[model samples]
Target: MNETHSPAFQREQLLAQDAATSNFNYEEFRMQLQNRISHLEKRARQLQKAMWISAGVLILCFPAVLVIEGFRLTEIPWVLPLWSGIGMLSLFLAAVFSGIYSSRYRPLLKRAQYDLQLSMITELQAQVAEINRKLAER
Candidate 1:
């Protein structure tokens, strides 16, 4: 059975492959690095938006429940009140979950950014080394 690689593992492998190249393909490496950086930036923005949305909804929960309870819509059955409470609870939980997920996404983005920086620095060093070699040959 073939072992399945996780996405993170796969990304690391790709970066390693690029970093390990003895002959640098400047265009391809730059494009790949730029693409990865842009992708991570876009993802981070989207997740940040989601986090803010979730936070807004979460913050509104108390007031929403208060407003609903204050309405005095029904008297005897109490079903609406019960359902409203449950609904609020569910919404709150969902918001919390979204926020938590967004938080996780942030670290992933940060790590990707760090990797991008490292790759850039490595490429720069490689270029410098190549230049030094040529200078020595002259």
Candidate 2:
């Protein structure tokens, strides 16, 4: 006499099989995370470079204006180096502040990325546990 397996038993067997096969592909996940991190880093570098370039151009133009116009503060009363100096100083300060802000945010970005990875790992572990439990029932 042949014994027939119930539908619930078959479903449980299938679940066990799927559980055994379910595994997290960490390498793929890590590569994706790295790609995102690299993109953010590139963007940060571009911003920093732009800030420095702008500051440098402002500084370079200040001297050129003085040389070409031959203007003196005592003579013209308005065409003074002091105003240019202040403008240059403002640009320099802006660049410095931007650099500091970017530096401060870098670690926060890293931490956010790390948290995302950790959350994914935790989810994978949970899936693995569930699969293991299903398999153990057999």
Candidate 3:
């Protein structure tokens, strides 16, 4: 008997086709989720590093300003470099205090690294669980 004439042949053919497509779709979706998770994690790390650098600079600004003022560099009249240094000091102080109500460095930075990273990681792990669930059901 020809294969097309057999009921088993048709059923097996359909099942094989479906399985192939489903596996492909699952792999593609999983890869997309993993890529997204990696991108988010990388961004979070970069942001954390940047935040730490900013915090360090802000923290150092206090003593740095005092040192500059104490050196009487501000008294140098018509010197562009001295004026620019004073201007930068003023700008740094302005940024440090620009935060609402508290006017602090840490709060303004918000320390958002951990929470954001956790959320994305949780999402990625949840997708993994979903994949496992589907595979188990199959």
Cα-based TM-score, every candidate: 0.44, 0.39, 0.41
Against the unseen true structure, what C-alpha lDDT does each candidate score? 0.70, 0.70, 0.66
- Clash number for each model: 0, 0, 0
Candidate 3 displacement at residue 3 in angstroms:
32
Better of 1 and 3 by TM-score: 1
Predicted candidate 3, C-alpha RMSD: 11.5
Compared with the true structure, what per-residue lDDT tens digits does model 2 show for residues 1-138? 222377777777776687434566768889999999898777766666666676776677667666646644446665556567767776876677577657754464356578789999999999999999999999
* Tens-place lDDT digits, model 1, residues 32-130: 999998897777677677656655665665576566567754453775677567557657766766676666665665565787899999999999999
Stretches off by above 4 angstroms in model 1 are 1-22, 74-138
Per-residue lDDT of 1-138 in model 3, one digit per residue for the tens? 997979999987887888656567777799999998788666555555555565566566667667768886667675547555665765565454443224323443456688998999999999999999999999
Model 3, global lDDT: 0.66
lDDT of 1 at 47: 61
lDDT of 3 at 27: 72
The runs of at least 3 residues in candidate 3 whose Cα sits more than 4 Å from the true structure, single-residue gaps closed, are 1-24, 76-138
Output the better candidate (1/3) by lDDT: 1
